[model samples]
Target: MSSAIDSKHDATHVDHAADPEKIHEQRGHQPGIFTDKDLMTNAFEAENREHEMTLWAAVKDHPMACFWAFVFCFTIVMESFDMFLNGNFVALTAFKERYGVPVAGGSKAIPTKWQSALFQSGQCGAFVGVFLAGPITNRLGYRWTTLLGLVLMNATIFISFFAQSLKVLVIGQAFEGVPWGLFIANSPAYASEVVPLVLRGACTATLQMSWSIGGIIVAAATYGYNKRTDEWAWRGPLALQWVFPLPLMVLIFFAPESPWWLVRRGRTEQALRSIKRLGRRSGNQASAEDTLAMIERTVKIETQTGGEPTLLDLVKGTDLRRTIITCLMYASQNFAGNLIANQATFFFEQAGMSTDFSFKLNLINSCLQLVANVLAWPLSGWFGRRTIFLGGLVVNITLLFILGICASITQSTATNYAQACLGVIISFVFAGTLGPISYSIIAETSSIRLRALSTGVGRAAYYVAEIPMIYLASQMLNPFGWNMAGKCGYVWGGTAVVCFVSAYFGLPELKDRSYRELDILFHRKVSARKFKSTVIDVAENE
Candidate 1:
């Protein structure tokens, strides 16, 4: 099949060795022999070498890069911990007694409006933080920006830990979200830049693993405290957040900066130094130089194609298409039933499960998600990104549809149990597929020149979409509001169908493709269906 497709586009492959002058003409320079032929050749050879390297070989060659990527991506656990704490707090008896108003059945409940507000306030701050991250990282670089965020996180946790009222807690969540935005937006891009192509998908996907780790920790903490009659039950989880930032700050201070960012800033010497630090095990100065040249060439092509990178350029030309794909890919997490998993503790309680059982189920759900995320690292390498993502979405849609059917029938212990179980299954499937793969896709989809900013935009879109979904999920679960219960599955399942369709038509297969190859394919406007099959010679001069 690949052979047939390659033959069909045989005319499209330009041979720079045969017609070097054509490269200059097509790239808007005068027809002439290459001025930096050695640099171009080294870059071409490096890209090909990277494309052919196995995952284990890449890991062995770049151990320091892997270590730093893990350290940076670990910052996401803080954000995930806080978000998970907020969602489960509503189910805490002491929390409701303190912050909630009177509801029916002679019991106290946090008003749906306040629940929605508390959940969305963080998202609002994250929205601002994501947009702010692009410019700040561009100026300060990833390491400094990360340190700044950690410092701010240390200061902001005071508000939540010491809050006297719900309003104060809301303000605290919003303030804390600013740094979280920095972490989420920066970490995946950092992972992408630090590692080789074979490690890129797994490293970026490790962000989701960190997130699930946070979820698991919070789940266990919340379960441990769910039955307590004092405010300490809720405050314990909030205070535990303080443990993450300082240690991460110390580690991040020692981590090397992104070489790609350095190259873009014209700090070639520093970029080479950073590359050496990243690939220390290889200890080959020549290989490091070739890698540096590869980054320089990709950056040059992006600049020639898109001119100066800006926020506005995200929506211009091929970049607009890239930006849309990244944004929607991130947003699809929510549309494809993640809200149900996120709010599982509250969701199960409202659906008539016992409070103790609900918390236990939430803990189980978190554990499953964590394991699924670990499994995804190998699955991603085996099945490829597009296949795993689309397959996961289909399974999610099917389970949610079945859950809705169970809800539509008579409400019973059996049906409620079925719905709760289905939510957990949906979450497991998501963690394995769409959840992790989206990180790789968004990181790979954007132009290297605009990668940090593009990732920010994509993450911002996730927070943006999350706010409404959080609100709607609150209403659907609240007895005083929509009271949809398991019926919410039908609505989310319908949305997941939309995501699957769009992805089928729009999500290209990016398995094992180098950044330069991706840039060439996007520049030429290749159809998504043709991406895996279309052949291009990376040796061809841009």
Candidate 2:
């Protein structure tokens, strides 16, 4: 069945590669040195290399790949602040109370409850945006889709500066969500496709590292403006996001398009041009040929596997069931209490800490996360995704346990400081492994057909879980106070168990496979946990 699908898709795609002019006309580029065959060869070579070598080399050699990886990492960091903002500072709450337009109930005013809804609405929009990627960007090309997303996100930030009402503010936020989905959906495949197969993991890790940078950006921005009374103080930090995207947009405009998307869309000539430029080889026809051949094989396999699976299929099919497990693995990270740790300021103050202390502590955690992210790149290579994700989950479970203890500490005896230090340590553990590595795994776990959809589903689940947590967070703190620590502790503990089980039974090893080869694995009826072992056994005996 898989073979049949591969052949049908391959035949359709190969026909386009045979006639390069058709692709050239579509992309509006003149005849180039490389041909579609050369692209095919390059892809094949990359895929055939051992997984560990390919993942790391991609990071070290390919500038274009690294650049996009950086953009994705930073984008996540920036967007994550929205999650922590209201949760972190009392000053922000003050701003809402002071400037907020009154509505029906004072507590449930336009800006009060509406602000919470805006966050949820943005998440909902993100779900829609993520779903949009498979069809729109899949047809349009990754480069174009990414650039469009970047523009919208930056525009959203710029417009947000002027938002007078909560409704207008959220509408701006919704636009930002779409671009985020595009980047998340496409960049993983994009980064993996461009590098030497040996260095793919490192390159992807570098992309994941951007989130730490984003964490720093949000933390620093929050800390810097924590006490400012000026109208533009908070707005200034928001406006700075505009600066990050403009230069990135220009770079992306000139950046090479995703070779896989190009090949899939039957634009083989452009695919050849892109691969050659990325490989830094001139007139190396073999590379282009390899790229085309691999893509041909992948497309054929996709066709045989059956049509793109729907959301319902996610719960029903073998490949898709694996995809769901992968999504759940990542979702576990979000719901695992890691985010609440980052947003600890809100809870800390509720426990009687001063506003100044909360900001300082949040900044400290961000710095710790930065150190951990840097450490993850080398650690991921040494440990691989499976080990790191599992280890992180275990450590997170322990930290949550400790946090519960610290939360019980009283302020009179300086025990609260100990609690703060423990929180920072937990942040370090999260940043080092699951934090950066999870996204890389998500990007690689599924085939192109369901990659975006799976990520959307996973992230949407993450946010959906967040909505309830956010709503009840303050209320929960009011009564249980220190006892509330166990709520997140339980969630993280459960998450750890799920991850362990998945690693033992459901998760696949995507450490070093090329996008095309990975596609073949998805078409089969193998168990996810067994895939790595299955692939390795076949490799070793051969």
Candidate 3:
């Protein structure tokens, strides 16, 4: 019955004049029975040409689609809250100053090391969460997996209001790892899939923008609330975070399911409907035919391979090599020594400032980072990835060395403030370039089948690296007394040098390429420009 249906469909496509030239090109495979099936299949495919044309035309004309695009952007923004809140412990500097335990019999010493240790615990929790995401998403699918994370995230934040002990604080922040991991693992892939290839960079960057925006909001809220009130300041910000996930939950309820997921499950009819909806929303800029062709090609690839490839499959060939390299690339971002440098408000206070001074300085640094994220759009848009990636590493490396010198010379004096300001400036510079662009490369480089797993692996590396970096930054700077913290410049400077070398030899140009083409670029010996050309050809042909 299935074969008969397929034959009839083939005949219908042939009568409607499917792309004969392309079909013939594919059919000239070899003198085999399989070649004959390809020709028959091409004939059946012709009937859908009209459906393709209409579906595309409708998508191009649809207005709601544009609105949904923004909906997509905002959903991603909610996830960006992880980055925003990740470092927000700075806002508690004042409270810590008045109430925190005294260190080594000091009258009013801030527990900077203790605080960093706590935060690193949260990062470690997030690592566990990231490791768990692959299996959860594999069993539950992206939508439900996100929903589960969202629920946990919101509950934890709300529960944080009741915290009286440091243990509870750690738990609140640690459980935060779950939703943060889920979103970080899945959101990039979702954003990458939703947009057309031409606007891929900008669209993905918009997700980064959402992150910056969330950071700005967190900074503004934490700074403003802490500045005005002495008590219940942290509570306000904690309570307000609940609002972030609510709207996203409502929208995802109404939004279309991922077409790729449907095709993977062999739900072709449903996938076609979802594609039509996407086309309708995109103002018909993409047709149903375009989406179907994409799904069809993807399905064909998977079917030919017999099943979804695993991590082992990645290790065997160019595809696996690309995955490993990309994972390391993201890992480098986490280990870039920037997070410690950026979130060092408590460290700054421990070094010599009063609690109030640390809070103000941390606010200022976050604000600067927000501004840098805004500014990055133009520079990253104009410059290619290689230049920005390498250049940023060099600039950061130079600053880290200079900072180490200043820290050693200043030793706990007024000059420390100057060194702190310089550190913030470097933070701004790093955020502007490598921040969003790193995400772009991560999203572009993985195959669809393995996207969730790859992203989870990459982010897991990031969080795992965070454990040591944050730990070292605190212990070496404080109790362990490595003097590296006091003159922390050399450590970060060395890290900067490593990043520069990595960028020079290891990174590939991923600018303006489709996700599919990225699959090829990572696997094949194609140049970046040629990779872009190949993707365009694939898109146009579809």
Highest-scoring model, lDDT: 1
- Each prediction's total of clashing residue pairs, residues at least 3 apart in sequence or on different chains, is 0, 42, 17
| Error of model 1, residue 233, in angstroms | 1.0
lDDT of 1 by residue, 205-273 (tens): 999899899999999999999999999999999999989988998899989999999988899999999
Poorest stretch of ten by lDDT in candidate 2? 533-542
lDDT of 3: 0.60
Ranking by lDDT: 1, 3, 2
TM-score for each of the candidates:
0.95, 0.80, 0.79
lDDT of each: 0.87, 0.60, 0.60
Q: How many clashing residue pairs are found in candidate 2? A: 42
Off by over 4 Å in 1: 1-34, 306-308
What digit string (tens of lDDT, one per residue) describes model 2 on residues 468-529? 55555443443322336334455455656666676656666666455555554665666656
Candidate 3 versus the native: TM-score? 0.79
Question: In model 3, which regions exceed 4 Å deviation?
Answer: 1-94, 97-99, 103-113, 227-231, 279-286, 309-311, 341-344, 347-357, 378-380, 410-414, 476-486, 525-542
Q: Which parts of model 2 are misplaced by more than 4 Å?
A: 1-46, 50-61, 89-115, 165-171, 281-283, 307-316, 409-413, 477-491, 515-524, 536-542
TM-score of 2: 0.80
Better of 1 and 3 by lDDT: 1
